[model samples]
Target chain A: MMQRRPMIGLALMAVASCIAVAARLLVVRTLDGSLVVGWPGPTLGQFRVDAVLVACSAGAALGASGAILQTLLRNPLASPFVLGVTSGAGAGVAFASLAASIAGMAAPTGAALGAPALAGALLALGCVLLLSRRHGALDPITLILGGVIVGAIASAGSTVAEALLPPERRGLLTGWLFGRIPEVPDMGSLAACAAAALGLTGLGAAWGNRLDGAALSDDEARSIGIALGPMRTAMFIGCGVATAATVALCGPIAFVGLLAPHCARALVGARNRILVPAAAVAGAGLLTAADALRQWIDIGGGRLPLGAVTAVFGGVAFLVLLRRTAAGWMA
Target chain B: MSALRFQSPIIARGAFMFAPGEVAPSAGRVTVLIGPNGGGKTTALRAAAGMLAPEQGAILLDGAPVHTMPAAQRAARMALVAQRPEVGAPFSVRDVVALGRVLRPASPERIAHALARSGLTQLADRPFHALSGGQQQRVAVARAFAQHEPGGVLLLDEAFAAVDPPEAAALVREIRAEAAAGATVLAATHDLSVASALADDVWCIAGGRSTAFGAARELLTRAALPSLLGVAVAEAHGSRGTIAVADYGGILPEAPR
Candidate 1:
């Protein structure tokens, strides 16, 4: 029974992914009402493809980052957004835009924004670690509280940056801040996000066995040949880079990182090598499906924020998971 | 057997410090560290297992300082089974056991054999957290056994405390077999009878000090046991084995001049 779980999960993820792609394709129809497959006039078909790719890549990045953070923190509740990485990235991009305007330069776009965002994410990660650490250890409660505090501070900084921006750019910035996926005008940006997601996820999978050992006590993990400090540092950095890149591309899409890994754990057992990739696939499916749902919902003229859509479902899942695993946490 | 020479002063900040001591487990033999509660048994075992780096002094395995060595290299030379083993998530018994083989090459046959020896073959597919405490301890033993390298050091801290007698005996048999096959085995336990029966050499610790270290038959005497444990000890020799029983309620007698 235990062995078959991962196989079933893989099959389900594959089916869900197929459905997500099919759903996105179906959303883009030609003038005659047929589903647009090849080229549809100017940019309609291409636009949907781009949206799907960005969603898939961003979701993959968030899921892998969450898996790594959960292992490093030894807390199942850990995720990129919970750890303040997303807000930090948002603040970083806002600061960059403000700097560009002050220098009388056009606002930076596409992949050029990922570098600063990554720096901010890493800084936030470091601050959370520093604040929560007590005698070289991190308790789950302290870590979570530290993350929330840092996230709030970063969010405030981002809001101030938005206020400083020119009136014309303010609306677009506000929309992005609410977790709308930005249009990538260039293929380079899309490829960059995809590369960052895949590269970091691959690195995470390579460290999967050590991550499994890390899930035990520090003493036990060391006894099994894992250098705890170095392992945690590596995982933290990987998670930060992946999350920051995704946030730079698609704003701060929440809950996919928090939700996907738990779903994966239910499908696959806690063998990290299998779980990390499984979570990535599940995350992609989840984000794509959420996007589809957002399009279907008639929220006036504008679409609902992707973050809001995911949070509505992911929040309930988190509550259920917390209740079910409360005893495990206490233990 | 691997020669394990542990010389260190273990310091736990704001808690306790184990005074400097050197203990050498004899080659091709089982050595048991017997001590009271809060007496630094786990600290000593941790230092020897390379889990705790000594504030001063060093632990040498085969004449090399273990603390200075890379983690992987140190792990390849020793295996430690903690007193209270915990899994962060619900992993299968097989997956938990596989964690022990990190420093060594993959060997499914070795993992299977260890599981069978620990009487956990039937529970291989079960979630580790779903098992009873005794069963969990046995799973840890199985993992340690799977991790054993030729002429390596094995350190177990109260590993069999929660296990049933039959399973504990089987684990003891496995430890003895490993020692005979050229592995140095050091275990810590509060059970003096089990220690006496299993240990080729015994180190009696009290108040962070090694009060005695010698042949188990000689060091585990009624008088030595009482002095070490702060209780009256009675020994009964039967056809089965020599049993050293402790009377916990008795007050400590005055020291002999």
Candidate 2:
């Protein structure tokens, strides 16, 4: 019918998060204020709330963006990290760090100031190279190659910037590169939420029929009376905007974009109309659960970055999926 | 009964051309287009089915400019099955067949009826790509049978070649049944025996030109067979004025029965 399995998956996701979130709340209320990383212990209510909010929001953003990019490019490797969006963000942060030392600015302030605009510029450049006459459309292989090149350039620039830093500012850039959610006192989270909401709305408005036709061959699509040019451009822009918003909020998380859509497809089947939304919701739910678990597992003093948690899970899931779909992938 | 017609239309692909003056075939008739390899037989079938744009021709359904209409609109009146059914997904045979009815709003009863007639009702649940070549070909024909208008044109391009003799014969019976029930059928094939058995009118093709367009009984002759094949025949025979190739020098054996 209408993705009965994925709908079941959606319900499972909600249940998993509710249990994890409930445990997190209990620990927070019992403990005074400290939260550890490995063992489930008592945690402060305020910090527990912070972790839940950050993890769910971060997961939703990363997952939704990843789903969009993978579907749009018909590529399994079109993640923010693999495609160099994170690397570009890293370069922007590095640049900000350099500017801060020269003018005495804080690292978080520098990243907040520099990353979004630089990401926009680099995103445009990547799109141009991909959609060039020589290239023509953002194919999965070319997009990955372009991302690698951009990422290499950005990584090198960040390294140079790190070497120049007076030891203190360097760690900040590294942490952000590894995907740390900055404690931005609600205002910054609201901005990320707004951006993600806008992107999701756009994705919703542009439903799955057109994209399904796109999954077919160009000749086949044309034979079925689908107009080619406009459909391609719209899909590309939609994916780009969604990924950009997520990267802006969470720096850049790996493997979500590369993995989520495929997972959704397996759970929901290849029909794009159901697949796209199911992927978005699954991504959101997975990230939310991961975030809740992160908060619950507070054994040591420092908190584990939610991005690292998702990467570990996403990477394993991706490998298993790769094995399951070797034939389809080859085709 | 609705009339099927084509005007002084030229359908060409690259350097080849296939066009003849207007001819409206009566209802319940099977017209077979026969030609040598690469002689615009497939091209004409594609044009007639509205898959190809005719450079200077007009196709008319009930004497209206069907060529000028959109593909979806044209598809409503005719169903086309290409040489090789290029299905590249894990769709069940039933799902792949169902895609033919995408343009037409067919009831499940009609769909089941078509599939049963085409002899694909048994293998309906198999994954399409997993099926043998002959099975896939049968599914393609069944899909076309499910999708067209009530009394539509079924344009088939070499649809029977991939199939075995019995299966192909059965398919021919189904095509004839469709024609008898008021559908204009145009089939393209290189096998002259099938043409002789199934066709009402045989349009013979050679060197990108169509000649000898007449009843199959009139056009199929003993002498024209060897020249048409471009090989010396030891001997030839006709059954009920139906042409059948026997032997090629010392190379091939005589026709069976």
Candidate 3:
């Protein structure tokens, strides 16, 4: 187990990001829904607090998933979304919605989507892993290609199922598909997401040394006494489960997973032990910041959707980071 | 003393199987496996390293089954320098070498010592990927050296291939030093000249079967190797007589030459 300095660094970063997010969300809102700096007394609502927790947990889950996926696939570009896990969850939710409509019921949200979403995500992950095996080992490029194909297939299925949903239910599906950062979350869903995030982050941190060794080729890793099968299986499944829980709570936030590790890697070195926690915390920070900014960037128009805010800002940041990363590698 | 024995056939991917064999390279000695490409040398080394499990027989490391040992324990007892080590990220050279002590707390002294031995001390802070192919191979050797316990086994798969001649010579010296310090070393190579210079014992393997040949001095010669190596062999005498001599030249026509 890694001690002291690195763990302290991770803890400090996590706290800083959390504090910054809370500061932003704790402001007072005017009559027209514009937020401004305000004192504490009667201003703080439980809804805002829940939103903060949701962003943090969802972001951390995606970030941890991205870190492990990148290490396992041996590609810096790998992420939970890259493997189409989120799309599989979407497809599961879509099918469940269709089923609900057939039985004359409203489509369930939040915690209710957890089981089906997890099943679909794991199924898609298994299919990708199965298809990616070459000469009895998983090839990184092949895994990416497999993920793309499987994700596309899952998305197509979701679309087909969505088309069959009732009119009112269709609107709910569409809204969820745009992605969410719900102020009022189902308590059970929030608990699951938080648990998944903590578990995945801890797992990544504990298996840090093995994850580092895994960056080498399978034969090299095996020769060093690192069993490739169990390590890969555990990490990949942990990533899948965490990602499914995230999708269930947040409906599929983007870029936090893909970008968080890069941010963390820039701060911490490529060692997975520190990198995993740093990435998870970095993700929490990114999503929390995005949520904070979502609150700030308001005019007479309605508040910017959390999904749109994250996509626009995170996409630009990723491009800039990508250039820097490419230059670093070249250097 | 260390003995690696495959008492039965070992199956690998493709149409490959190690013919039943036994080769015991004692402690404080350099044992070389000399053979043609696609022969069972690498397969045999992998089996000995416990990377491959036997289909019919047991791979024993000094009477104890190798494949049955817990992976970490097996790794602690042995170190392997693979033919081509694939590293994904741009880790520093020292970081790569330090990975050898994955089970133990990293010792800077050990890493530095291994680097010096492998002639890689100057490249310690450099990114592993930035190094040339030969340098990378040296790094792999250094990693194995860092992991090696004095009395433990060191297995090298094609330890001399693709490296520059000078580096390869340096590596031979380093390997010899390791053997002198009581490590049992088994190295596989198609480089017959290096084998002549480095080995105390030779196992000539071909056509998927391994045979325990005699001493490297007696076996690594034009007269002895042509029939065993499936290629024409040539002798080049050096200052140390046979140390820097005897390399294969070309294929032998089945018809009388």
Candidate 4:
């Protein structure tokens, strides 16, 4: 009953992605009540493709990052957000805009914005890791606590930066924070995010054996010939980089990172080699599907924020998965 | 068969300081470490298993430096079963057992062989967290069995602490089988009855000291440790097969630095 299911996850991903892409391509009602439906020719197709590509890359990074984070922390509840990286990235963009206003300079966009986001994300992750070390090894409880503390502090920094922004500029940061699939995403940010997602997923799969041993106690893992320190250090860094790239591309999309792995796990079991890739595809499908859903639903207002759609739907999906697989988190 | 001999440096686990000492066990034999609680028996086994590094010197398996060996290489040569916290996730019994073969593919037949040898073949599909302590202990043994080379080293610390009499007897058979297959076994246990019957050599640790307490076959047969417990001792048996551990670390003097 517990054998590895490599192809099932792939097949499900293909089905989900194809459906999401068709939905996204076939119809779209623009914000001004102009219904653009059926066969979006070359120019429009290219735009749709770019949006889908950005969403998939960011979402894949998030899902793969979350899977590795949960394993490294040995805590089932762990996600990209738990490590404070996403919030830190938000703070970086927030403070950068605040700095730009004070300096009377135009705010950075695309790759320029991504640089600070990556820096802030990595800085926050480093602090959490540094705070959690005991005798050169990470203790799970200390790590979880450190992540929570760091995340809280980063969230506060974002709120402060947001409060200081002028009303007109504030709207841009607010819209960014609400998360969206950019129709014209900077090609460089998309490429970097995609590379990180694929790279980290491959690394996770290559180190699957060591990760499996890590599911046991520290001493036990060591006995099985796992160099716990080196493997943990490498995997943590990989996850951090992937997550940072995700934040750089998408401004803190919530729940997708946490939920996608569970969805993948439902199909792939916990063997990380297959699980990492499975989760990546699952994340891609989910975010694109969410984007497609946003286009379809109308709530007597302007287009719904991508973040709102994800948070409400993802939270509900998470609750459902949590109820079904409480055993997945057992100590 | 590998012979283990090393001078363990002064090791501190938490606030407890284990004083330095040396223990050399005969090759291809079962050597039981006997000690009072907090007397550094676990520290010794961990050091021997290369899971804990000595502050100075190395644990020599045959002539190789066990502590400095790369983890993957070390795992192919040595296996350890120590008391540990419950596994962190709901890995299947087979999944946990398959971990022992990290250096190689976890073939189903090999995993089943290890599970069957440990008397847990039927429970291979169960989640590790769902097992009783005795069954969990058996799973630990199964993991070691899966990873272990026939002529490699096996270190056990409180490995049989959770098992019932029948399971204990079954595990004893497993240990004997390992030794018979030319592996050297070092187990840290308080069960003198098990030590008495099972051990070939003995390392009696006390007051943070480890001493090579002589052959179990000779000492237990002579009933030499009758006075350690200040009680009646078992009568000598003429047969060479059965022996008792007149063994207690209390009788051994602290080793000199």
TM-score per candidate for chain A alone:
0.83, 0.79, 0.88, 0.91
TM-score (chain B) of candidate 3 = 0.90
True contacts kept of each: 0.60, 0.07, 0.48, 0.62
Tens digits of lDDT, candidate 3, A1-331: 2246556667777787877677756764565876678545534566777888898899999999998888888776677887678788888888888888898876787667767776777788888878877756666678789889999999899999988876667765566666778887878888998999999999998988888788777767777778777787677778877887888788888888988888787667677888888998998888888888777776566677778988898789878867765644323
Error of 3 at A41 (Å): 4.3
lDDT of 4 at A310: 94
Give the winner by TM-score: 2 or 3. Answer: 3
lDDT of 4 at B34: 76
What is the alpha-carbon lDDT for the whole of candidate 1?
0.78
lDDT of 2 by residue, B129-244 (tens): 67778887888888777775567887888888888888888898889888888888888887777776678877766655665567665655556555564543332344444455
Q: Fill in the DockQ of model 2.
A: 0.18
- The worst-scoring run of ten residues by lDDT in candidate 3 chain A lies at A322-331
The sequence of per-residue lDDT tens digits that candidate 1 reaches over residues A208-320 is: 88888888777788888888777776666677667777776777787889888888887776778878888888888888888877766765556678878988888898899
**lDDT (tens digit, per residue) of candidate 3 on B153-216:** 9999987687899989989998998899888888998777788778988888887876547888
Q: Candidate 4: where are CA atoms >4 Å away?
A: A1-4, A30-37, A106-112, A166-174, A321-328, B217-257
Model 4 clash pairs? Answer: B196-B244, B196-B245
TM-score of each: 0.87, 0.71, 0.89, 0.89
lDDT (10s digit) by residue, model 2, range A116-163: 434643564464446332324445456556667776777788889878
Error of 1 at A44 (Å): 1.1
Residue B195 miss distance in model 2 (angstroms): 4.8
Of the two candidates 2 and 3, the one with more favorable DockQ, higher being better, is 3
User: A-chain TM-score in candidate 1?
Assistant: 0.83
Q: Which candidate is the best by lDDT?
A: 3
